[model samples]
Target: MAASSGRFESAKSIEERKEQTRIARAEVLRQAKANFEKEERWKELKRLRGEDTWMLPDVNEQIEQFSKAIAMAFSRKPT
Candidate 1:
């Protein structure tokens, strides 16, 4: 990430924008980490579908659900 250039006007508000930015960044990273496993599963499912694996349990529905869940997760504001 690029460093914030606070070269403009001096202090006005007591609230620190840097802290808010850090919190937002951390939340985004946390969400990405939580979703990483789902992404891997989706990729694996695709790969297995490409192969001749007939004994594998059906996971296409679950993958679709995961996609929806990921969308919901990203659409909400971090609490």
Candidate 2:
């Protein structure tokens, strides 16, 4: 009976170790996937920003253009 119990305990320990290893491996894989996704998002954003340069005009220029458009629209006095 004692020998059988020892064997059972050993088997249980082995199973526990295997489960722990599996959980650790799964965590590592999850972290790697997350990092890869984050990097991909950053890359996509950088690409969309257009060759490391912002294509939009300065704020003052944008405001000026908007004001001009508004003035033109008001002056047109309906088709």
Best by TM-score: 2
lDDT of each: 0.76, 0.84
What are the RMSDs of all candidates, in order?
16.8, 10.9
Highest lDDT model number = 2
Q: On residues 1-79, what C-alpha lDDT tens digit does candidate 1 reach at each position?
A: 2346554544544347767888999999999988998888888988877753434345766776899999999999988
- Poorly placed runs, candidate 2 (over 4 Å): 1-9, 52-79
What is the TM-score of each predicted model, taking all chains together? 0.36, 0.54
Candidate 1 weakest ten by summed lDDT: 6-15
lDDT of 2 by residue, 16-64 (tens): 9999999999999999999999999999998787755554558657887
After superposition, which runs of candidate 1 have C-alpha atoms over 4 Å from their true positions? 1-15, 41-79
